[model samples]
Target: MAVCKGCGVTLQSTDPNAIGYTPKEGSEYCQRCFRLMHYDDLTVSMRTGIDPDQIIEQIAKMDALIIYVVDLFDFEAGMIPGLARKLPDKDILMVCAKRDILPDTLNHEKVARFVFARLKELNIKVKGLVLTSKLHSEGIDDVKEAIRMLGHGRPVVVMGRANSGKSTLLNNLFGQNILTSSRFPGTTLEMNQIVVDGITYIDTPGIEIENSLLMDVNESDLKTILPYKTIKPQIFQLHGDQSFAVAGLARLDLMECDHAACVWYLSDKLQVHRSKVQAADELWRKHYGELFSPVPLEENFRVSTIRKNLSKMDIVIDGLGWASVSGQISTISVRAPKSVNVTFRKAML
Candidate 1:
């Protein structure tokens, strides 16, 4: 039976609105899996189609080492902790995918450190980490070399967040189309395995969901979220403690800095406005639906009041981009969907 490319469920052409509905070609999944793939609720997102528990079960069955790919742009959001905790025995080589999209000014050390720290938080032990740009073929060979060094005759289980280039990486390694891919998220729904150079490459769908940055956005907004070309970093120089919001879905509090602290490296298409940390709420209310437009009024999340202060935190507005704040003995309240991550970093600009 062919699996649905959208939800990784077994396909059935019987029901048009059901999961895996593929007409005569037949869907690749059941009805439930399909709704979860395109739905708005968190419960839908936590379903088996993209759940870490399901992925962990599959990971446990693999005999070879594991290669966990992550999006450099949305690393925090794509992280899967439970999967790592479940696969205690498998050796993991974390691959930081999509290097071409990040701003050139991104601090490499900070980025690497963040990835390592985030992986550790997920309880994933790694032999090494490779920063890669699948579009540029930057570290694909290194990934291959790492697989070779593992010396596991079994297949290499390739894992990562949704649309993190897991399929494309395999396509490059095997020089064949073993797994289908798209520019949008939730593209690869099933677990695809391809053997290359005596190595089995396991492809799994993206697990984590930071839908706050994705949902409610149309095709035009998608361009702002996942840019194909190198994004021009938008830097904002702040005098002291200040706050910023992207499309009303995310907020940032730049804590105290002795120097003129600069918050740089976000999506060029994203609109960033700077003001007093306290005025952030007012600015958002005034400009969210008008100036800094991201989501539609009716479709946006019902976030009436922002949450309390989040101190020393790094908030990445999925797709649009992320910000690393420095120079502060302060905090700011925020609110959004539970799927998005509010983290802290030591400044990677």
Candidate 2:
């Protein structure tokens, strides 16, 4: 039941060289991940818990067929270039899982287009994209038919990011919830194959990478990260040197305001720093644990000093929120984990 952090494989007490291995009272990792961590250059040969590359290599050596499932909500981050790049010879059919939770405004065609664009960025060409919600059984037959037609009698592989609902979809395909479902992240931690009639499908573990970003954070943090329900957008007007903290996960230092020049778009539940930008530092020094509290500033989440000029470039705090500048401003700096991606964008506000 405990999942491996290194490769997301399930842990078992039986085989030390098996997919799941828990060392004596210490830690657990899939056998392949253990070898990757401990033994350099030694690779998984013929067992489960194989690394993504090994999985890709296996897929590459296959007889040309697959269905790549991607979490539509986090498609950009869940991309697997190793698999996509290696399986070019095989027919690649992309399946977008979790259609039920998408905001109503999200156009299905638009999502497919976005997936295509992201795949292109990864240098992986695809034949088509299918969107589905296995929970509701939508688009199931279409995906089945697509795979059946493209696979041309070869075994079909089902691979995707962890929690993308692959197991859920598979269970639905079998008309029951045979797979275990949980509210936590990274639940499915291994590649499993289930056969229906003649087609055999392979399920791979969700791999982590630079793009895992918000995916790598703890579930509690994600409660502050992914906005599940509607959040009323908050906007704050401030004076020079205004500072604000976002659920204690991030901070914003606002300088000379031409327009609003504020950090907007945080979780509706998080408190925005409303005091003068000048008092921002004093506020943190005085009340980080007291008033300006989000998910308390943990040692693990801490980052070095953040200092950068406002410089009119839009600052985006990944997961939580972002800010846009209007008028003259100096530098604004923030410090958070290196995992959090801070990117600049044109002002959308």
Estimate, for each residue in 1-349, the C-alpha lDDT of model 2 and write its tens digit: 7765444466777876655576644465555555545552233332122355665666677775667777655444456656554666667887887665555566777766656666776887666778888556888888877876787877776666555666666766667644443323444455555567777766555444343435445454555565554345565665566666765566766555544555465456667766675666677778765665554323244333333444545566544456555565555666555566565544433
Q: How large an RMSD does model 1 have? A: 5.6
lDDT tens digits, residues 148-237, model 1?
898467678887777677777777777665455555566566676555666666678776454535544554466665667777766666
Candidate 2 TM-score over all chains jointly: 0.64
The RMSD of every model to the true structure, in order and in angstroms, is 5.6, 8.5
Off-target runs (Cα >4 Å) in candidate 1 are: 2-49, 105-110, 176-178, 196-198, 210-212, 215-220, 253-258, 277-279, 296-313, 317-320, 333-339
My TM-score estimates for the predictions, one after another, are 0.76, 0.64
Q: lDDT (0-100) at residue 194 of candidate 2?
A: 56
Best by lDDT: 1
What is the Cα-based lDDT of residue 228 in candidate 2? 50
For candidate 1, give the lDDT of residue 260: 39
Name the runs in model 2 displaced over 4 angstroms: 1-50, 81-84, 209-244, 252-277, 284-335, 343-349
Give, for candidate 2, the lowest lDDT window spanning 10 residues: 40-49
